[model samples]
Target chain A: MSYSDLYRNAMEKATARDAWKAETIEKITAMQSSHKKNTSVRHICFTAFRHSMVPLASAALIALMFFYSKNDFLSPSLSDSSNNTPYVAAFSANDTASIQEQTAPIGRSRSIAIFPNIVEAPTPEQALPSDSCSLDDAVVSTEQYDQAVALLEAQLMEQSQDGTLPVVLTKSDIVAQGYFSANDTISVVFALPATSMGENLYYVYEIPLI
Target chain B: MEAILSPADAVEVYGNMVFRAAFGIVKSQQDAEDIAQDVFFSLVRTNPRFSSAEHQKAWLLRCTFNRCNSYFRSAWHRHTTSLEDYHNLPFTPEETYVLDTVAKLPVKYRQVIYLHYIEGYSTAEIAQLLHRNQNTILSQLSRARTHLKTSLKGDF
Candidate 1:
């Protein structure tokens, strides 16, 4: 066969898959419409807020911290040094010490706050009553708990400005083991939601009171 | 110049051509389909104006070729590959034989041969689409034809 004949034969056969063409067109249309909608300011803002809830929360916390720090709402008595163990110091001494150790090189500004935000403690059924208990152990009403959680979340957003997304502590994610009055500390355990790339980190914080 | 055809109409007219151009170089149907989608997606996003239908087709073909080259250059594609076999193509035995022969040619020759013989694009057109000197395209086409002639001695 001549090259001309071969070209004719090959051209005749080199067609795209029928099913793929239909599927592709459908996908393109869907993407175009979604892209159109996604470009709107409201849609973009909503999508961003939905996807980066953790980051947003962290930002709010940082802003609130700046406000509190500037106004002396969070006194020096409740600073990181007042606590016997710093959160980072404790984290660095544990098995996952590397997580905190790596932060030093990143040069992120760090601060610790003792929030008096939580007005209620865990109930007796939820927490063990210690001999030094002075505050009443009561389950906070859902509304009060939510308000306190929002305040704490805002505080956390402030703490995250150093670019560390430490466990995103939210009301839903926290398990309040109750407050200890002896050292004026509130112990809480929380887990960070898995990152977009699927990394999950758990954390515990013992917030002190002035 | 403003685009002569709508995005959907352009894709309908030139999608197969774009797919074939991409498939000619990549030797992968799935990758070719992806390149076609990207070409149209870019068209919709950029809404570039073309002087005529022929200009639009050439532009689409050029984009397909560039995307295919980029796919080959990508480290991820280089490290991991799951290419579809030539025999598995939906073509008659003779057509498969021709394509398999074409696929075996060097990358430069493969593109020149496809555009020249199958797609019926002239050497000058191919060079312009690829942004190469016409002499370079002519040289690649000559080398490709010789290789095909030798590989399919009796068939040619």
Candidate 2:
């Protein structure tokens, strides 16, 4: 037989092949029913998850904002010691000057009224003499000494407006003093000290300034 | 009254087309049934939008072909007896030995032969369906014919 005749016979045989009958159709329909139900449930779950994405993101954002605001409120107290170091230095300077001026002997029986404005300036370590004197005794009254210390604290706070009191160093000054090398490229290094959290615990930060 | 077709009506219309397409590949009643059910289940789950009946038919054919290719590659195929073995069994041999031989050819050759003869699809149409160049499909069809002629020489 020719090739065309052979191909024609093949087509007839393929077309005449047995197909699925009633019983098999019933089984397949049943399988499809279960599959349809399962697929519907899966689609519902996927859609619900997709819809919840926005609200979930918003809730996370709100939580982040609350945490940041609470931290903002507590920030000043943690930083107070470092921030007020300049004021403390100025107060000590005023106290030293007051002590040197009050070195003379005083008359008895008269009550020493310490005014609120009587501030004794503190002396710097370099300016203070090593010699022992009766300067401490001259301002020995407890009430007067307390009043003088309070007034001196107020004066130092006013002097700290321009931040000229050399008590606490700024970050720029620390960098400028050659404590760290300056380069064009920024880098971050993390050092993990032995601590209670874990042996492998490490703190990491990216320093944007070189 | 306006006619409202149920999901079952949609399946009945499309299911036959899917069965024909699947039967083309598997050449078995049982395998075609499984593939048809799978195609119907996929249609229901996806709820794919089709512009017309022609589009739906094309989609079913594409899906059925994919499922049949996968089934052909599966481990079950290794365990199953060949179509040649099926011919010698108790069932009446409605299909001639020549046709059976062609059906039992490797999937690539069988597909080209089936599309060319049984489906009456042009080389371009077969190329489009198989995602091959027209020239490649024509060459494949030529090779399949030569192979079939050589195989069926003694029987003819």
Candidate 3:
């Protein structure tokens, strides 16, 4: 047979063998159905928690931003109209009171909701020292962080008038160690371990003593 | 103008075409199948609208070309494919000779050759499908034909 004919015959056979089967098409259809499924009810704040380490890394970064945030929410330059990434949302959350009002208290992040009050670019002599807060060398290791945060959690547990503090302590390490000197109190960030399986998520607390 | 195909219909109709084009580029049955799956996954994910059946075909072919490039660049594209298994297929001597010669061409040449010769796409259409310049497509086709002619003892 001719060159085109011979190649065409073999190519057709291979192509036929490799072609999509009914089962594959059904799978694609099922995938399409799932990809198109609308889950509008759940608040979509899991972008930071996409990876296990991501939450820890993000918490450390958030603590950093809380420490040194310029408090320039209204600066047209920092948050441009085009930059719509989650980073911008986080920066903007620290930048504006109104956006924090609307978006804080979102999902479990209960994450950054507490930031606006404390992290809104503090002055050197502010009543609360939110601006100086960070996961500094005080938290030399996870071991040190657990000890510091555990002490703070225990202290805060005693001070709660109602059982509002979710301080059910599991071994899951809390996030970045940040603290501030309030006029009469010392505040710290800690993890209230999930009540069941032994993974901890980030939480906040105020311990008045040293 | 034929009716535009739904994404599922497009996969059914064009899966072989996508696989063959991907095979021509990647030179592996497994890699070609993977590229085809990735192409259809994006197609299903996007559910992009097309104007006609021709548009859908062109879109699938374009997606195949793109997926082949990205997946080939990916680390999974280790060049350990053994084409000795292809010989086990029931090909006549001439067909086997043609397949081997065609596969021996450089990947770019092989791509244009299969699209132009076996799939009956014009160099212009192939250029558009492969997203290379028309001149580049023509040059590759010329070199491929010359190589095939020499390899096939002037049969091409």
Which ten contiguous residues of candidate 3 chain A have the minimum total lDDT? Answer: A83-92
lDDT for each residue of candidate 1 in B38-149, tens digit (9 for 90 to 100): 7776665445678887788888887787778878876768898655554566677766777778788888898888788767889999999889999999898888888888
In terms of DockQ, the best-performing candidate is: 3
- Runs of candidate 1 exceeding 4 Å displacement: A34-210, B1-3, B154-156
Which one wins by TM-score: 1 or 3? 3
Interface RMSD of 3: 11.2
Per residue, candidate 1 scores C-alpha lDDT tens digits across A1-210 of 675576556655556464566666765565455334323422333233334443443344344323323322222222232222111111111121122212222212122322212123344234332222222111222333333334445554555554555544444544332322212234343334555545444333433321
Report the Cα lDDT for residue B18, model 1. 82
Candidate 3, residues B15-73: lDDT per residue as tens digits?
A: 88888888777766776787787677666544567877777788887788777766656
Sort the predicted structures by DockQ, highest score first.
3, 1, 2
Is candidate 2 or 3 superior in DockQ?
3
For all candidates in order, the CA lDDT equals 0.54, 0.43, 0.54
Q: Which ten contiguous residues of candidate 1 chain A have the minimum total lDDT?
A: A85-94
Task: List clashing residue pairs in candidate 3.
Answer: none
Rank candidates, TM-score, best first: 3, 1, 2
Candidate 2 ranges with C-alpha deviation above 4 Å:
A1-210, B1-24, B83-95, B153-156
